[model samples]
Target: MSVINRVLRDLDQRQQQQSKGSYTPAAMAPQPLHWTWMIGIAVGTAVVIVILLNLYWWLTIDTDPALQVVEAPVTNQPTVIAATAEESADQAVEEVERGTDAESASKPALQRGPVKPRELVQVPPSPTESRTSELEEAEATTEPVVSEIPTETLATVAPEPEAEVEATDTPSTFAVERVQLSPNELAETNLQKARSALRRGEREQGQELLEKALTVMPEHVAVRSELAAYWYGRGFATRAVAILQQGLDRVPQQSQWQLLLGRILERMGRIEDAYIALQSVDSSSAEYIDLLEVRGNAANQLGYFSEAAQDFLALASLKSEGRWWLAAAVAFEDAGEPAAALRAYRQAAFARDLGVDARRYAEDRLQALGGS
Candidate 1:
């Protein structure tokens, strides 16, 4: 059994050795890629990279050569279209020096070609170069330069005779003429001046102006009213009344005149005259409140208790004052209207703004009238 095992082991060792000998190693395998092929590939990739880099550079480069050049002239310098007179003179001098002025000038003028338009160009010449170019231009034209007119042309162009404008005595359209005022307008003007003078304390001047206004138009209500107001303020009540009456005689429908007259008469203690003057005053007059107050007092003084009560009630209706209510109650009591008097007394006694004496009087009146 041992001998057989040794033979089998020997056979296994021989089989292993034959298998090892039959298999080829990686280092001994056939090479698919050579160094030359790798070198060639590397070279081609490098060339391709260089070409791409160059192509990118060409595309990204700024190729405008004019943008690199500095602007020769200031941007603000005015463009020089034609040469100046001095340049023309210099050109003329040079042409005379050349001895063939007509032939040379005519030749250049005939040989010159049409000018072509150029873009993205800056041809601003130096001062000396400009002068030279002007001289060349002068030599190239046989006709007179822009700055000089030939003697023949000047002689051919005669001066036109100027027309003479004759001076005439014509009235100016804008001259201010004196405006002629009518008598009424003149009176109004004087009245305004009188009022202004009175406001300034020029009493004598104001009176004179007022008189002048009345003289111009005696029927002038406004002038008469102003004069009456002035006289009334100056303590000349009779004169003021006289002036207002004169206005009323002429313009009887003027309610303001009547109001002023009534106020003056009432102040002068002429109660009957005041009542008559105020009777004609319209309820819509601006002096209606004054009329109510003065007429009411006048009526009460003259024993016209019913009219006085009506006036006081109207005033109460207008202002809702406790004093007015009390006045209304007293007038109603005197006029024999106990019901209205009692109601008015109650209102006065309970009034929000009643005076102490007024409220006490209202309470006594209410108690007398048997009101709660």
Candidate 2:
């Protein structure tokens, strides 16, 4: 009874001591977030978005070899000239009258079939398109057939005054006027007439018309070129050279004239002259690539393999074609530059963007160059 009383008294004293003080709650552990942490989270999120966008672009866009980066069409085409006032008027009339091109004039305006020209009434029908109509008319009419006249008798027949009057009454196609038209107008008219003549297959007449145009506008480079081209296309290389030479004589240092002359000479088989002429041509010409190719050909013809190789390489830069690359490689081989030739051959072999024949030729060259 003495031990139990002692233990009970100690427990009651401890309970009474804790009841006298205020009760306190447990404290939580500290967790801190600063500005730097927020910034790092934002930056990480932005980086992830950027990476995803780049991946999308990579999958969607594919650049092809034949793809071109087009710019605004502002390059000066020196060879082309604007249409004249007369030509513009003609075009406007043609448009306003038919709401179409010149060919519309051949169609009937108020009939179901093609228009029959009214002038054919007083004039005999041409042998070309009206032959069937003429034959049908002769069969329909009961006109008596005259006796067959001998060729000699027809040739020896006296000239009729009516025929002479008709010949004299025929209107001239063009009446040249000194002051009625400006120099440009004169040139343009002649140029148009020349083109029409060419289209009509009157080669000699076309040449004459172009020459007349050149005479009217002596300083006109385009007219000069047209005349030169007219001769060149007809296989008159010497005549083309002469025309270009005359132009050059009037004004030396004309890069176009020189370039064209060089081309003509190259065609004429005057290799040395062509090389010399081409060497003097300015690099700023509109057809710089053609000049490079022609000069390369000239150099090749002149046995200047090193120069030819360089020129062909420059041309290859202008046109990324297998044929140009192959030409450069061949020129390099001729110039004893095996290393450059090998590189070019490889490029040409892999240049599938070029023409079929060019790729085939390049592959053949690659095989010949001891490459797999």
Best by lDDT: 1
Give a tens-digit lDDT track for model 2, residues 1-372: 999999999999989888776556578678888999999999999999998886664333211111112343565432232443356446545433443333347554332333223210122235663566555555655468899999999999977799888988998698887678888898989899988988999988988888888988887888898898877888887888888888888987587787788877876778888887777556777877777888888888878988998888887778787777888898898888888998888888788777888877767867787775
Q: Work out how many backbone clashes candidate 2 has.
A: 0
What's the TM-score of every candidate structure?
0.51, 0.44
Residue 122 displacement (Å), model 2: 53
**Model 1 score (lDDT):** 0.78
Report clash pairs, candidate 1: none
Candidates in order: C-alpha RMSD to true structure: 25.3, 47.5
Clashes of each: 0, 0
Worst 10 residues of 1 by lDDT: 59-68
* Model 1 C-alpha lDDT per residue in residues 1-372, reported as the tens digit of each score: 999999999999999999999988768767699899999999999999998887665333322222224345567534454656566556545533442454356555234333222223234456998788667766655466577789999999886544322223344478789999999999988988988898899999999999999999998877888888888888999999998888888876477788788778987889999988776667886778767888899899999999999999889888888888899999999999999999889989889899898899899888788996
TM-score for model 1? 0.51
Which stretches of candidate 1 lie above 4 Å from their native place?
A: 1-178, 182-184, 218-221
Residue 101 displacement in candidate 2 (angstroms): 96
C-alpha local distance difference test of each model? 0.78, 0.74
Query: Any idea what lDDT model 2 has?
Result: 0.74
